[model samples]
Target chain A: MIGMTLILKKINQLIVGLIFLYGIYIITHGHLTPGGCFAVGAVIAGAFFLLVLAYGSDILKLRKREEGSSVAESTGIFIFLVLAFTALIIVTRIFFTNYLPKGITGELISSGVIPLYNIAVGIEVAAALFNTFLALYL
Target chain B: MELLLSIILGLMILGAIYALFARDLMSALISCGIVGYGLVICFLLLQAPDLAIVQIVVETITLLIMIAVVLDSSREELKEKKAAEVKLSHFRKWYVMNVILIIVCLVVLLYFFKEVTSTLDPLGKHLTRMSTAYIEYAAEKTGSANLVTGVLFDFRGYDTLGEATILFTAVIGVLTILRVKGKK
Candidate 1:
């Protein structure tokens, strides 16, 4: 029975990891696919949920009792705004306009602001969701 | 053409009514879920996949949060009761309010939906028609595979920042509500 339980635990972790990877895949392919920042973020959050359920609150890596969660939440917001402000400043000063280069299409390096925006959004959403789960669960 | 539109409209109205009139909080919540599902259907009908994806995520999170809050509050109540003799007065009251709120919310949402769809401009039309070009352009520009990310972060990055801040505020609100003095 104990051995069975241990194997089940390992399988759970593997499943969670797969789910997390799937979320990343979805987020990264959001623009070209059916998923997006929100979908992928929520899926990533689901991975955490799976972990919490499998290991219980005590074993979860992202704890609700930690002050770091709140800090992380704010940091995502701060980073997003700082990046945006930087872009705005650079555009207004150097290029004489806010026009960033819209590079070649569908080659993993296009869309001036779209990918950066998606990533920022993904991070923001993941952190916010984790914070929410922690606050409620803890 | 009209038949399809009317079917969707009918589903929306029915979902709204069910969401509002359900007798239990859980049932009311389920109704809300239906409302959300209906909204997604409507979004698809309008051919707005981007908006639909965002809406699904937002709705799912909202539902999760609501469920969490409801679960947390109920635990305390459950502990104080013998589980058998517990009355559902609060649940009943919430249901009544839910219907009223759903009606009000549906009216508001329906109005906005009609207005937005009608007012879609030439630029909006062009963007949807040529979204592939934008997606391809975004991929080469942002060094990311996610086109939504490219557009949202690189082009309209400021809006994303604002959205992050709103989420941060919600986290703070949750913390403030749940935090206990002298308890880690």
Candidate 2:
């Protein structure tokens, strides 16, 4: 563990989880909210950075994430393609069509496939960027 | 609103110029961040919360990366200079010339700034012609209240797909570039 300071560690313990939760909230509520995939992805990546910066990059909990980041990235893209192709192959003959049931206008589950896309993109961008950070960091 | 945005814009430009001239790479990088964060404020002022969120996050991430780079590269201890007087004189000459050139550039930019402003539509008076269709049908057709996501994920999903692929490729590229040579 390459910790910088005890103050940073204390601050990070208090703040990083909230930032991560906020990122998840942004991703899930993307259809109803302003933020979506890319924004939330960066937010989550920032959370990872904050944690690593405080607790050191060698945190065993996060090491698994960095290790599987490439796989996670591919999985995200794969899910996106599967969602699109499902729209194409199954019911709607068009690509990327919102085939799922559209719930209420302002509800969380309202936007048919938009939230799904948000989740996929959030995963994709978060993993890719976090991977880069772990790599470039000394 | 326009006045506030303009002030922020001026600050951004000044910060950019300061970043160019600042001797300490750390402060220079932080001033560079001023430009990015200022744009986030501009986005919010323009009623684009989506863009503002995106901009701020990406800006912070990039800034953190830059901070890491600078922190790793710069030494904590200062090294004594062997030829301080001669180096200072030579450095001052080059710095003065660069400052003069930057001032000339700033003058040209300021001179043209009015013309550019004159051509632009006032803030918040943006022409809604291109966005009107999305504004109308995005909610109904896509069933998403946030029209930005509607258009991005449903309407023009191919673009999003391509964007994701591009990010994947970039990650691969970075990993490749950073790979340790002769390490299995």
> In TM-score terms, which candidate is top?
2
Q: Is the docking of candidate 2 incorrect, acceptable, medium or high quality?
A: medium
Give chain B TM-scores in order.
0.54, 0.73
Q: For candidate 1, lDDT tens digit of each residue in A1-138? A: 011256767988679888788888866666566666766667777777556645666674443446565665666566656555665576554321225466655555454555555666677787778767766565
TM-score of each: 0.64, 0.83
| lDDT for each residue of candidate 2 in A1-138, tens digit (9 for 90 to 100) | 386888888888899999999999889889998988999889988998888777776783543423777788889989999999998899789888888899888898887888888899999999888888777653
Runs of candidate 2 with Cα error greater than 4 angstroms are A61-66, B75-130, B181-184
Query: Candidate 1, fnat value?
Result: 0.57
Model 1 iRMSD vs. native = 4.4
Model 1: lDDT equals 0.65
- Alpha-carbon lDDT, every model: 0.65, 0.85
Model number with the top DockQ: 2
Consecutive 10-residue window with the lowest summed lDDT within model 2 chain B: B75-84
